[model samples]
Target: MATVRVQQADFDIGAEVAAVTAGRTDIGGTGCFIGTVRETADGRPITAMTLEHYPGMTERAMAAIAEQAEARWSLLGCTLIHRVGRLTPGANIVLVLAAAPHRQAALEATAFLIDWLKTRAPFWKKEHFADGAEAWVAARVEDDAAAARWGGGTAGRDRRTMAPGGSG
Candidate 1:
């Protein structure tokens, strides 16, 4: 079983990793990734970014991502915590930790979880510039490509996936 959390409160990286690996004697390796608000992008400083998410769908989507990771790898344990609402620069935004007997599975599972979350989760981001301007973050084609890797191309496409010419 895996744990998934979507909330306004931020998560503690050490605590989450501890909880994920607790009582797991079989786990020989753990891979952890924490995504935080960055001060700059490319090279320019980012003033702020507001993150929004659908209530029910956000949790469900994250759970499904975790489930897929477990199914695709020999995972002993995993934890995903995502923060919502207003957040400041340098704050923790999300955490993903995967525990397994080997490093490969742990690493791959972590990537799969974040990639799927970025593409499929209902979260939206709005970047606010230093001059007091805001814009809704658009879903990048690169993110979709990342998710497709774990999705195994068209064979594993879901309802969220609609062909370019198909009505969405």
Candidate 2:
């Protein structure tokens, strides 16, 4: 099973990783990704960012994403934590961890999870600039392209199943 959480509080990466790997001797590799608030967006200086999402809906969407990752890869465990509400520059925004029997599955699953989250998750973000202006962040074409690379699209589309070895 996968653990998913959407909270306002920041998460400890080390603790989360340990929680996923604990009592798991079969996991030979673990892939992790941590997203943080940057000091700048585009060329503008960003002071802070506020993230918002529909509570129940957001959790359900994230859980589905995790499930998809586990189905597509040989994953033993997964954890996804996304922080909501206002966040300052350098603050942690999201964390994703994928554990599998081999490095390829672990790494690819992690990438797929994050990419899907960026494009499919229902989180909304508003950026506060240094000039005392605020604007809602728009969807990026790059994120959609990243997700598409993993054969991501409409529901019910068949995705290639990957195992420990090179064969899929």
Candidate 3:
């Protein structure tokens, strides 16, 4: 099974992992990723990072991504939680966990889920520098490549890109 959530509060890694694998003995390996806000970028101070997302649409997209990952790999369980709103310098941004029968499947699926989530999900990030200036973060080429490895970007399949009364 796969679970997805978007919340403002921080998450507990150990609890999240335990919850996902509670009764699952089939999984022999588990993979996890925790993304945290960095305080410095090459000695420059970072004040804050604000994340923007569409409430209903973002959740649906994330659920779909989780489903895709579950189907693409031999996954026993998966959990994805991404925090929104204003976050301080060292807050946890997101967490991706995957459980599988083998380490390879667990690790790769975890990476794939996060990489695709970054590009496909409708989440935007803004960075505040120490000088008090803030700027919307530009999408990274590395993020593009990460999503591309799984096949393609979210363009045509994006819910927001769909017609007003139609699914994308």
Candidate 4:
């Protein structure tokens, strides 16, 4: 079973990992990725960031992404948790865990999940600057390039061209 969550509360990484691999003797290695809110953007001081997503739609999209990852890798278990609402610098934003019988599979799955999540998830972000200005975050070319490596880019079947409400 895969673990997926979209909540505003913080998560315990150690506990999550333990839960996923509790009785998994076949799991030889576990790869984890923790995303955090950054303090700056484009050399500008950032105060906070707010993440918004369509409740039901967001979860379903993530599930599809997870399924794709499982199809590509020999994964024993997978976990993806993303925090919503306002977050300050250094706060935990997302956690991705992948378990497999080998380190390579685990590592690759973890990387693929994150890259796809960044590009395919239906999440919108607004960054608050220290100068009392805010702006909606735009998709970056680097992120698209990252997801493209895993065949989940804009051209893929699992691609998320526009966010919820049909906005880009």
Q: Which lDDT values do the candidates have, in the order given?
A: 0.80, 0.90, 0.86, 0.89
Residue pairs clashing in model 2 are none
TM, every model: 0.87, 0.91, 0.88, 0.91
In the predicted model 3, the residue pairs found to clash are: none
Give one digit per residue, the lDDT tens place, for model 1 in 73-109: 9788989888888777898899998899999999999
- Which of the numbered candidates is closest to the native, going by highest lDDT? 2
lDDT of 2: 0.90
Error of 4 at 137 (Å): 0.7
TM-score, model 4 to reference: 0.91
What's the true lDDT of residue 65 in model 3?
Answer: 88
Candidate 3 overall Cα lDDT vs. reference? 0.86
Worst 10 residues of 1 by lDDT: 152-161
Q: After superposition, how far is residue 59 of candidate 1 from its true place, in Å?
A: 0.8
Q: Write the per-residue lDDT of candidate 3 for residues 1-168, one digit (tens) a residue.
A: 688999999999999999988887888999999999998754778899899999999898899888888888868999999999999987999999999999999999999988888887889998888999888887776877777888855552433435667543
Runs of candidate 2 exceeding 4 Å displacement: 156-168
> How many clashes show up per model?
0, 0, 0, 0
- TM-score order, best first, reads 4, 2, 3, 1
- The lowest-lDDT stretch of 10 consecutive residues in candidate 2 is 152-161
Question: Considering only N, C-alpha and C atoms within 3 Å, which residue pairs clash in candidate 1?
Answer: none
